[model samples]
Target: MGVVEADEADRPVSSIVLIEPANRADLPAIVSILARETLLGVRDSADPGAFPDYERAFEEIVADPRTTLYVARLEGQVVGTFQLIFFRALLRHGALLAHAEAVQVDPEVRGHGVGRAMMDFAIAEARRRGAGSLQLASNKQRLDAHRFYERAGFEKRLDGFKIDLSGH
Candidate 1:
C-alpha cells in the first residue's frame, strides 16, 4: 500500500503514515512498541535474549499464507504494528474472516491518525481478499483501546472468551 497522508481535521497536517508488510529489520521496533505501549507489555519483552524468539515468530508468520505482519511507518520510522490473519469459519457458512491482532501505535503518535490509517488499510485489505468481515478482540481491561476500535467502526457485537494453554 502507498503512504496515507493524515488529513483529519484534528490531525497534524504533516503526518504521513505508511502501512506495509514488515521485514526482518522492523522486528525490533515492532517488539519495542508491543512491549512498551500495549496492555500485553507485562507479558512481552524487548530484551536482547527475547529477540531471537520474535525473529523466529516473524519468520513463521510470513511463511504462513493466511497471515501477515504489518507495520505503520511515519517518515521512515516504525510507529505502529498489527497482524492480520484470514480463516474460513464454518459458523458463518464458510465465510472468509479476517482477524486483526496485536495492534499497537506508539504513544507519541496516538492522536495523529496513524491508528485510523492502519485500520483503514486493514479493512481495505480484508475486503480485497474477499473476507466477509474483519474482527478483533481487545482485552476487556483496555477501555481506551475499545473506544478506539469503536471509533474505527467496529461494534461490540459479541463477548469474546479465551483460555491459556501454555501450561498444558
Candidate 2:
C-alpha cells in the first residue's frame, strides 16, 4: 500500500531495494539477465533474442508516457525488471487500464522478496497513474509465479490460453 523501503542492514544478504524506471544504461544488464532467465530449465528453446528487444522497446516505452518499465535495484545491482502499459478506451470515459509483462528476477535472489517489491512498485505506480485496473498473464508452466501473484492479492481472471499466431 505505502512505500516499500529496503533496510540498510539487509544489504547483500538481504535488502528491500527500490524499483525505478529502467534507463538507457541499464538495458544491457536487463537484456542479459532476461536472456539467462528465459533459457533456464528449457531443453530446446529458441534463440536467446526471442524475447522483446529490450533496448529498442525500452526506448519507445520511455518516450511514451502511457508505458512504464521498471528495474529493481539492491546494493546498486539490478535484480528484477517489469513493465506496465496503460491503456484507455474512449467508451470507458476516464478509466485507465494497465497490463504488466516481462517480469524476470535474478535466480540468486529468488526468495529474498525482490520480486514482491517489484510487483508492489508496479501496482503503486499503476494506481498513481490513475489506472482503474491492472492485469497480467503468466505462462501456465510458471506455477510458482502463479502462487506469487495470488499471494500478492491477484485473483486468476482466466486460464491464460494462447494461440500461436507466429506462423512459420
Give the winner by TM-score: 1
- All candidates: CA RMSD (Å): 1.6, 4.2
Span of ten consecutive residues with least summed lDDT in model 1:
35-44
Q: After superposition, how far is residue 167 of candidate 1 from its true place, in Å?
A: 3.5
What tens-digit string does per-residue lDDT give for candidate 1 at 1-168? Answer: 657778667487787899999999999999998888645547778999989999999999999999999999998999999999999999778999999998999888887888888998999999999999999998988898889899989999989889998884
After TM-score superposition, the amount by which residue 93's alpha carbon in candidate 1 deviates from its true location, in angstroms, is: 2.6
* TM-scores vs. true structure, each candidate: 0.94, 0.80
Stretches of candidate 1 off by over 4 Å are 38-41
lDDT of 2 by residue, 54-116 (tens): 556677889998877888887788888888899886656867889898888888887677887
Q: Highest lDDT among the candidates is held by which one?
A: 1
Pairs of residues at least 3 apart in sequence or in different chains that clash in candidate 1: none
Native-referenced Cα lDDT, model 2: 0.76
Angstrom error at residue 156, model 1: 0.5
